[model samples]
Target: MTTMFRKALNALPRLGVQVVDLGPGAAVISRRGRYSATKVSADAWMVGGGRRSTRAPAEGWGLRKAAASSLCARHVADFLANYEVNCVFDVGANRGQYGRQLRESGYRGRIVSFEPVPDALARLRKAAERDPDWWVRPVALGRSESVQSMHLGWKTMNSLLEPSAYGQQRYKRFADTRTTQVQVRRLDKVMDEALHGIANPRPFLKMDTQGFDMEVFAGAGERLDEYVGMQSEVAALQLYEGSPHMTEALAAYEEAGFGITGLYPVTREETTGRVVEFDCVLARVSSVPGSAAGVRP
Candidate 1:
C-alpha cells in the first residue's frame, strides 16, 4: 500500500468504521476488502482532526473510541522509549508478533521472546532468525520449573491454565481445548542465564500469557525491581483457575513496586458490555516518583 493510502486509512475510525487494534498502533481499518493494516507511522489523531470528515457520524462514537484505543496503544509504545530499554522480554510470544510490532513502532532495542507452543515455536524461530536483536526461547514461564500441560487455543489464546466456563461462553475458540505438555521455568532463573554478563540490562517485561500473567510475575519477583517497565494482560473475570483478575492484578503490581499508569482495552464483549481483558502498563513507583506515570500511594 502507498503512503497516502495508509494515511487515509488511519482516518477510518472517523468514517464510522469500528476499527480495532491488533497491537500497538496497528488496526483493521479496512471494511471493503478486509485489508488489515499496521498503522504506527502516522498520528491517527492528527489525521482524524484534519482529514477524516465528521459529516458521517453525528455521535462520532466509533471515531472517538477507536482513536483513543489506537492512541493509548501509541502512548504505551512511546512510554517505553522513556527508558533506555536493554531488552524487551516478550513472554508468551506466539509467532513473534509483539516483537515485530515493537520494531515497527520504532523500538530498535533487543527483544528477548519466550514461547513453548510447538506450532508457535516453529513459526517464532523462523520469524526471528533474521533479526539479530530479536531472540527466541523455546520455554514457558510459570511459578515453577517443571513440565506443565498447556491448553491449546486455535490462535493466540493458549494458556497453562484451563479456561473457565465464562471465558468459553464469551469465546469458544479456546473452549474444550487440547492440552500438550511443555517445559516450564521460572523467570528469575531464566533471566540470569539468558542475560549473564550483560551489565546493567534495563529490561522491559511484557506478558500475554492468556491468564497466567500473575503466575508469570510470581516467578519473576526477584527480578521485578530490575525491569524498567512491565505490562500484562488482565482479565475482568476469572478466565482461568486462580489467575489474578482486574482488582487483584492491580494490587499485585502495586505490591511489586509498580504503579498502574495505563490501561488499554484489549478485548470486550459486545452483548453485555463486559471487558474481557486489557493491557495494563505499569511503571515503577519509586523509579519515577512524583511523575504522572508513578503509581500514587
Candidate 2:
C-alpha cells in the first residue's frame, strides 16, 4: 500500500520532488511543503519505486525548462509543425540518443544516423533496430572520399578526428591508443549515392562532430540548399589542440547561406574549467536585393 501510494503521488502533476544523494547506500527524499513551495527533507529508503542510491538531485522546473529550451526545442517544434521534415540527418550520432529523443518528442521523421566509431555504430544499430524509419551508417564525414586515420579513445564517444594529447585525456589507459583507419566521404557524395532516390532534396540535419563541423559543411559546398536547418555543436575554446574554433566554423555556415537562429550553452557552471558548448541552429536565409555580406539573422 505504501509503495502504491508513493507511485500514485509521483504521477501527480505539479508535485515538486527532490532526490538527495547521501553517498554510498543512503539517500533522502524531500517533498514540497503543503503550505509552502520550499522542500522539507526527510530520511527515506525509497521513493518513486526505486532503491535508495547516491545520485544527483532532480532539477527544478526552471532548470528543466531551461535545459529543454537550450536544445532549440522551440525551433524544432516549429519545424515539425510547419515544415516538411520528412527526413533527418543525425551526423556523429553517438549511440542514437538524440535520435531517440527526437522520436520521444513526437518527431515522426525518417532518421539517417552516422557514426565514425565502429563500436558506437554497432551500438547505434542495436538501439535503432526496432525503429524501421532509422538507418545507421558507419562512415566519417570529411572533405574527401578516401580512407583516413582516426583517433579512438577508451570509450567510443571520445573518438574523433582530432584527439587531444594533453588536458587529462580520458583514453590514456588503453594499451593501443594510436590512429585507426576509417572510411571517410563527403556529405554531398553520400547523399547523392544513398538518398538520391528520395523525391525531396532538403532534410533537417543535426551535427555534433567534436571539431569537424566545418569540414562537413565544406564537403556539402554548393549543396547547402539540400538542408533546411542544421543543429551543430560549436566549441568556442581550444578544448583539443587541433580542434577548430567556433567562430571560424560559424563563418563557413554563413558563407553557405545559412543564418544563425539560436545559441545555447550546455553547461551552467563557470568554475568547472569546462568550456561552453553551444547548440546552434542555422536556417537557410534568402538573399536580399541590396544587402551587405556581413548581415546576419
lDDT of 1 by residue, 204-259 (tens): 88999988888889898677888878889988977777677789988988887888
Candidate 2 on 76-149: residue-level lDDT in tens? 65555455566788888878878887887788778888887877888899999999878888898877888877
TM-score of each: 0.76, 0.69
Which residue window of length 10 is worst by lDDT in model 2? Answer: 35-44
Clashes of each: 0, 0
Rate residue 158 of model 1 by lDDT: 87
RMSD values, in order shown: 8.1, 9.0
What TM-score should be assigned to candidate 2?
0.69
Q: Model 1: C-alpha RMSD to truth?
A: 8.1
Question: What is the alpha-carbon RMSD of candidate 2 to the true structure?
Answer: 9.0
Which pairs clash in model 2? none
lDDT at residue 41 of model 1 (Cα atoms): 34
